[model samples]
Structure formats: C-alpha cells, structure tokens
Target: MTMKWKGWALATGALAFSATAMAAPPSAEMISFACAGCHGTNGGSAGLTMPSLASQSKTAIVDAMKKFKSGERPSTVMGRLAKGYTDADFDAMATFFSKQKFHPTTQAVNAAKVKKGEALQEANCSRCHLEDGKEGKDDTPVMASQWLPYLQMQMDLYQSGARKMPEKMAEKVKPLSKEDLDALLHFYASVK
Candidate 1:
C-alpha cells in the first residue's frame, strides 16, 4: 500500500477503536437490551398481554423494579427478572425506556364498558392516574393505552394482597368487581 493510504487506514482504525472504547461495554447495555425481546424494540410491544415500557416514567419503572425485587409486587416473570438487576441497571433501563415515544395500541372496546370505566376513573382512579391515565405525579405511571391483560393482572395482584398497596388505595380497590375491572381495562386500553 502507498504510505499515504497506510497512514489514513491507521488513523481510521485508531478512531474506530477509540469510539468503541468510549462506549459502555455490551454487558452494561445488555441490562436494558435484554428487555427488547419481550417488551419489543424500544418497549413498544405487539403482544396483547405484554405491557409497553416505552415512554413510561423513569420513576415508575425504577419503583416497580424495586417492588418486584423486594417481593412487594406479584408477577409471573418480572419478579424473577428484576432479581438479576442492580439499582443502577434498573435506573439505566428506566431512563432508556422513558426516552422512547409511546404510541397507543388499537384495541377493541365496548361503549358500555368504557362508560363504566370512565365513571370509576373519575371517581377514584383519576386522582392519581389522571383522566387520560398518563400520570398525576412524577413517580406515577402512565396507565393509558397499556395492555388490558397486564393492567388487569396488576389490579388482581393489588386486590389479592399479592402486591402491596397502601391502605387508602386498598380501600378503593375493595369495592371493585370483575365487571368493574373489565370496564376500567377497556377504557384505559382505548386511550391515547
């Protein structure tokens, strides 16, 4: 090779190496990357039951991970999955997910169910989750447009004591029936 070409190649190689070195290692990123398989790319899930993590509040994600790890929340896999992550990993994953845009899913809903849910929400749920279910506070989560099954399961957990709940929240859930939950789920599923 010409001397000039060799020098150019060497500089390019050095630049590439430095770029790679400056970036965090794959394992550090894997802590968040591991969720893509199930949560979908950037946490926009196509699964009917899988909850979307994209655009979720970072505080909500971190809190949930801590809850799952501490045995304060019930889950089929999240509890076990959370056990593998450290606080830093959880925080990084939360930040990664919170940056993504949240696109609402198209799920069928009944008018009657939505109406009932709207009532329930206006009365109790909206105080914390807001009318659109995005969030009422910084740490609160966006419940709007989440998968119905996942929302229902969480409600079930909260109601059954499988998940810890404050006394005030518990009181509100105490009066809920199956139909009530279904209505609420349908309503939130339909929101943007």
Candidate 2:
C-alpha cells in the first residue's frame, strides 16, 4: 500500500479502538471507592437516613447528581460532593451503581399497613415515582425496594416541613393526611 493509504488505515483503526475503550464498563473498585463511606460495600447504607444506591436506575442517579450540581435538589453534603464531579465522572458513577444487585429486605410488613400504604403511594407518589415506585425521572429517587424506615423518615420530614424540597413537592405533600402517610410507607416497604 502507498504511504498515504497506510496512514489512513492506521487512523481508522485507532478511532475504532478509542471508541471500544470508551464503551467499556466501569470498574467495581472505582465504584466501591466512591461509595464506601455512605453506601457501604454492598449498597446498604451506613445509616437509616442515607438512601441505598444499589439497584437504582442509571438515569435517576445521574439526574440526581445533576440536580445537586445545579442547586435544584437541596442537600448540603450532596451539593458539595456533586459540584466537584465532571459530567464524565457522574456518568461513570451512575453506570457503576446501576449494575449492583440489592439484597431483599427480610422484615415482614403488616397486611393492614400495606393496604393503607398502597393507597397513599397511589394517590401522592405515582406521578413521579411511577406505578411500581421503581421508575422515577429527573432527580426523583426510586421508592421501590428502598429501605422502609428510611422512606418513612423522609415522609415524616416532608410532612412536618423539616425537609425542604422543590416548591412543587412541598405543595404536593402538604395535604397528605396521617392515614395517607401510613399507607404510603406500607406500600413502598412491601415493593420488591
């Protein structure tokens, strides 16, 4: 082959290799290192207050990080941490956690409580959290398979006006009755 043709072939091969490298999956070690402090080794969080990241959607995870960076989602610690991440870093982290499988909760939920919870979740949560409470878009956390105690506490915070979220969210939950809260908690706790 002529020199110019050989050069062209080399360039094409290099481009293909670069694309393949970019598409490779992120390493487990990198994911673990980034999440160890709050989410523990297996995606179970260190405390009840922190949400588990395992089994969460890649889209939801990235969206939350974007919200934190933009100051739309209000969390002092998360905002600060998200600010330092580049778009590429956020994508990598989201991809990493989305692949981790979550362990099932062993605690049993009461039947009456579950009935009430289902009603509350259907009325107030379905819009954003989706019918199964597993799919959420644009910075909303998935409630399906989430820790029940953690979910309950967040709801209480929202109801008591202790947790400040987007204005629309506060407005949505403002009218939730006590029965509604109980029902919502039960419904989410029972979801796999």
Per-prediction count of colliding residue pairs? 0, 3
| Winning model by TM-score | 1
Model 2 ranges with Cα > 4 A deviation: 1-32, 108-110, 135-140, 156-175
Candidate 1 structure, TM-score to reference: 0.81
RMSD of each: 4.9, 6.7
Question: Per-residue lDDT of 1-192 in model 2, one digit per residue for the tens?
Answer: 355855675777754555554444556557446676887665656465677777677787888888789877567588899988788888878777776775345446678978877777676667787756766455666677666687877776666665566676667667877766776776776787
lDDT of 1 by residue, 34-74 (tens): 89899888888888778888888888899989988987877
Return the TM-score for each candidate structure: 0.81, 0.66
| Error of model 1, residue 31, in angstroms | 3.6
